[model samples]
Each structure stands twice: as C-alpha cells, then as structure tokens.
Target: MPQWDIAVPTRPGRLPGTTMAGFSDRANTFVDVEVIPHPGVTVVFDLGDLPLVIDDGNGQERRGPVVAGLAPNRVRGQGQPGSFACLQVRMSPVVAHAVLGAASEVSGAVLDLDDLWGRDALRTQERLRAATSWEDRFTVAEAALARRHDAGRAVDPEVAFSWARMVDSRGQLRIDRLAAEVGWSRKRLWSRFRSQIGVTPKRAAQLIRFDHAAHLLAAGHTPAAVAADSGYADQSHLHRDVTTFTGSTPAQVARAPFLAVDDVAWPARR
Candidate 1:
C-alpha cells in the first residue's frame, strides 16, 4: 500500500462551505482504492501522467477529471503503476450546486468534468498541472470554483438552511421539523431540496448520518457504541445503513483508507 502525500491549505481560503486537499503518490505504486459514500460532492483535477481511473462495478471505467456526486456508492479508484498527483475539492451540497454549475443536480452518479464544464474544465486542469507547488494548485482550483459559484445559480435559502441543520445534528434532525424551521411545507421542501441539492432530505440525512458513523468507526469506535451514538435504531440498523452506503461491514469501514486520510487532509474538521 502506498501512503498519500496530502497537503491542505495552510490558511483557510475565502470559499465558504468548501475544503481543498492535494494528494500525490510519488512512489511507483498501483492503488485500487474503495471510495465510500460521502454527504457532499467531490471534484478531482487529474494532474498526473495518466488520467484517474474510476470503476463503479458496472464493467465501465471512467478516466480524467470527474465529479463524484453526493452518496455515490460502490465506486473505486484504480491507479496505474506510476507517480500521480491531483487536487481534490469537497463541497457541501449547498455550495456544490453553485460551484458545479450545470451539474447541480448530480447525485448518485459520477460525471466527467468536461461534460459539464466543457473547455473550461480542460483549461482548469491545465492550470493545475502547470502549478509549481501545492499552494499554487490550491489557489488556481479555488479561483476556478469561485468563478463558477459566482456565475452559477445558488440553491434556495430554505434548502441550504435545512442542509445546515442536518449537518449540525449529524443527520439526526427530523425532516418534519426541518421543514417547519425552514417555513416551507413538507412537499415544497422535498421538491426543492431534491432538485437543488441532488438528493431528498431524508436520503441526505441518511447519508450524513452514515458519514458520521463511518468516521466514528474509523476513529476506533465500536459499532454498537457508534450506532447508539449516531441515532441508528440499533446495531442492525447501523449495519444495514453501512452496507447500503459502502457495501462493507462495520469492521471493514473502520479500516477504510479513504477515511483514514481524512484527519490529515481535513484536520480542523476532524
């Protein structure tokens, strides 16, 4: 197994609701990484000798710059034997709608960046590949995100508020109460949230809850304890959720390489 050289911003950038990390594998390594489901959206800028390979178990593999939408499941990254470097950005569904522009309704799928950004995506990749340092790459990436965010449409305030509440509650918040708090009827909230955020509120909450429980498991917490703490009905409920989102058991999730790198990549949040 090859460990990633992860670099995060020394100081927080101006972009709100977004985080950036740069990952490079300098050794001649072939890595097959199982990617777990996450609550937010992910964008990867491939800056390596070869394009990033993503397999979703559908007998098809996608390469190059791609966006992993919220709750993308059963996906894996298979890197060829050689050095590889990339800049990765994770955005809240709220911010992702704006930053991702045409791909705003992305959920449960991985789409090529060029399909959405067209020539702009290729230009941004070139800029990232040309950067002399990780810091420069981060700068270029953030600037590109900022531009898209500014020009793209934003989600409704109610949708953003509901998302924040779910995140704050670690996905334990009730959907009914969220709608009330947002001053929208349940039907309206559901329709808007699904359209703008890419997933329904209930599903989003489940994903967020799964994310929290996954991290706790990665932190060495026992499944039973994590289940009780994360609002799962019981260990069985937790088991089902974990299996649904990650296609892995609690034990397997606890040792996931993707989660293991989070503390180093997003230390403050961890």
Candidate 2:
C-alpha cells in the first residue's frame, strides 16, 4: 500500500458532489486490487499503456477502461498491469445517474465505458492521456462529466433527499422516518429510491454504515467500539457486514490497501 501512492486532484468546479482521484503504483510487479462497494458510483479510467482487467464478481472478466456502478454486496477485483496509473471519479449516486446517463444499465454490474459512452469513451481517454499534468487531466475529465450531467435528466428530488439523509446520519436514519419526512408512502419511497439510486434505501444505509465502520476499524478502533459507534446492533453484526460487503474481517479490512489510502485521498470524510 505504501508504494501505491495516491494523488488527490485539486477541486475542479465543473461537477458538483463529485471527487476526482488518481493512483500510481510504484511497484513494477503485478498485484491484486479489490474494491468493495462504496456509497457512490465509480468511473475508472486508465492512463497507462497496459490493459486493466476487472472482475465484477459476475463470473466473467471485463477489462478497462471501464465504468463500474456497484450496489451493496457487489465486490470487484482488478489485476494490476505491473506498474499502473489511473484516474477514478466517484459521484454520489444521485449525481451519478445524471452524469453517467445509464444508472439503470450500470446498476449492480460492471460494464465497459464504451458500451455506455460509445466513441466518446476512447476520445476522452485520448484527451486524458494527452494532458501534461494530473491537474490538466482532472480538468478534462470533470468537464466531460459536467457536460453529460447537464444533458441528462436527474433523479427525483425525493431520492436525493433520502440519500442525503443516509449520508448525514451515517446510515443511522430509519427508512420509515425518511419516507415520512419526504411525504412519500413507504412502498412508493422504496420503489422510487431503488429505481433511481440502483440500490434500495435499506441497502444504501448498510453500505454507508459499513463505510463508517471500516474507516473506524482502519483507524485502530476495536470491533465492539466500532459497532456501537457505527449504529450496528453489536460486534457480531459488524463482523457480518464486513464479511458480507468486503469478504474480510475487521482486522483484515483495517490493513487493506484500498481503505488505507482513503484518508489521504478523501480527507473531507471528517
């Protein structure tokens, strides 16, 4: 993990509720990379000359450059091409549907960007690779995202409100409460939310809660303490979630390379 240095791009004003990040692997040997389901949708672009292989737990292997939208419990693996460099854009699901223009298509699966963006995917990659600096690349990428987001239709406001509640409460908010607050019946809310956000409201809450607990564990908190602080029922509940979402125990996730670099790459979490 130490050798996999992450570079955080300066905030570009093009896209709202989006974070652009870059990772460079100094190690010139092949390594395994696994990404658990986070609260947002991920769009990964390869800047290197080698191909990036991705397995979306779909019993088939898909290669990058790819756009991956994962629901809760959808695990993905990446085979690094010895030395690799890539840029990843994480958009809150509410924004992702609009930005990617394929929320329903991308939900619960990983697909090549070409399928969604067509020729634009390769064209964007060329622009990204031609950029002189990471900053320039970030600008180019964000501009593209902004264009799509502006052109596409957005999710329902109720869906956005429910999602905000999930994040603001760290997934501790109840679905019934969210539905009441948004003036939607429980069934209606559930239907719209799952359709718009890809994952259901309850599942989204679990993912957000798991994200919080994972960070706490990585910060050296005991499972018991993390469970209590993260609003889980107990340590066993936390363990089940960690295993279900990540296929790893608390101790293992604590040392995970992907979660390890998050603080530096996404420092706004605090």
Candidate 3:
C-alpha cells in the first residue's frame, strides 16, 4: 500500500484534540487514499467533484459525498486513484453552523458534498488540485468560508469555541460555570448553542460522554472501569448511554475488533 500524505493544520490558539489526518490505500489500487474523519461537525472541501465509490457491503455502490452531517454512523468510500485530496475543518457542531450557513439541526449520515458546493463544486475541485501544498488548500478553504461570512452567513465564533470547550470536557464541566467563564448568561448561551450547534448543551455533553465511554470500552476496558474512567455515574449509566448511542453493550463492542478501530464517534471514533 502506498502511503498518502496526511496533514493537520496548526492554527494559532485552537482548542486541543480537534484535528487529525490519516491515509489508507487499497492493496490492489494505485491511488493514494486518505481519510480525514472529524468531530460531530466539520467542513469537507471539494469532495463533491471527486470520482469516488462507497461500498456498504449491501451490493450497492454510491458515488462521491457519501456522507456528511450526523445521520449515518459511518461513511466509507473511495476516491479516484490519484485525484482525491481534501482539507477537513473539524469543529464542534456550533462551528459547523457558521460554515454551513443554516440552523437546520443537521444530523444523520448524508453523503452529498457536491450539493453543499452547488455550482462552485468544479471550480473548488480544480482549485484543490492546483494547490501544491496543504497550506495552499487551507488558504482556499479559508477564503471560501470568509466569502460566506461576508455574505451575512456566519455563526458567532465565541459561541462555537465555547461549545468546543464544553464538548471537549465530556460533560465534566457545568453549563453555569461555562456561561460564567464566557461572560454570557445561561439562557443566552443555551440559545446560541442550540441554534448554531443543533443540539442543546446538555445533549451535546451527553454525546461527548457517550463517545468517551464507547472508546474506552472498544479499547478493551471493563464496563465498571470504563464508567469510572469516563466519569459516568455507574456501570448501569454507562451501559444505558452506550446502548442509546450505539445500540450495543460494552461487551458487544469489545467483541467486535473492527468497531474498535473504525472512526465513528463524537470527537471522532478513531
């Protein structure tokens, strides 16, 4: 397998544990394959214009933009042998609202990158291809986002950054404290968070907790130990959240080796 280059941008003063890059290649193919799985919210660039295939093992194949948002638990697809490269901006769900330009409570796995770009898909793809470095690609994506913001379609950065901090803490932090830290009233904080991030602050916290618990379980930790480590109230509480988020018990997840490594969690299930 050829090793494709994966680059994570280093933006000044960004939150921790928010970005990553990995490259994978099929044994029989020549194209360098890369996967950039982001958090609950992210921006994928120029994926719509790529020639790719998604296989779900159901005897069906889907093309580019195989999945976006929070609908599907996983998005698996392939890009052209050498034509697919992307820079993903993984943000908390709140940051997503700023870039997506809508407050539509986006969720479920929907693969339609082309639809997101609309008429500019081809141009964006070309620009991505023309770039010789990841930095160049980042510049293009940033400019595109800036244009959208200038058009009166932007989410409040402070709110988005706050939400990122909240989720990063995995519900360990309290909303009241969070609001006070950010100098906003509880009501105002919740309002902006829900509008931009799609889920209430409480729900987002739960999801982050669920994600951490799931990762520990998948990594072979005992349920009781995982519960303690993940800040769950008890083993039963951990089990409940695991079932609610993934429809399975800790033991079940532990038994599935593939699930352990697959990228599919809130902060990204890698």
Q: Could you give the C-alpha RMSD of every candidate to the true structure, in order shown?
A: 1.4, 1.8, 5.6
- Winner on lDDT between 1 and 3 is 1
Model 2 scores what on Cα lDDT?
0.81
lDDT of 2 by residue, 1-270 (tens): 326767777664557778888877787556467786677888888876666677777677776667777563345555455657788888888888987775767777788888877888888989998998888888889888888898888999999989998899999999999999999999999999888888788888998999899999988999999999999998899999999888888889988777878878777651
Which prediction has the highest TM-score against the true structure? 1
What ranges in model 3 sit over 4 Å off? 1-5, 10-22, 26-39, 45-50, 54-62, 65-67, 70-87, 109-111, 132-139, 149-158, 161-165, 175-191, 218-220, 251-270
lDDT by residue for model 1 (53-112), tens: 988556678887889898876888888777777788889888888888633447888888
Candidate 1's C-alpha runs over 4 A off are 102-104
lDDT digits (tens) for residues 1-270 of candidate 3: 334445544453133333433233323244422222223654455442346565433345655332355323434455665545445555445544554555453544444546655655556656866877766666665666555444535567667667667666866788888888888998998988777766667777777776667666767789999899888889999888766655667787565433433443223431
Ranking by TM-score: 1, 2, 3
Q: How high is each candidate's TM-score?
A: 0.96, 0.94, 0.66
- The residue-level lDDT of candidate 1 at 52 comes to 75
Note the Cα lDDT for every prediction shown.
0.86, 0.81, 0.56
Per-residue error for 98 in candidate 3, Å, reads 1.7
Give the higher-TM-score candidate: 1 or 3.
1
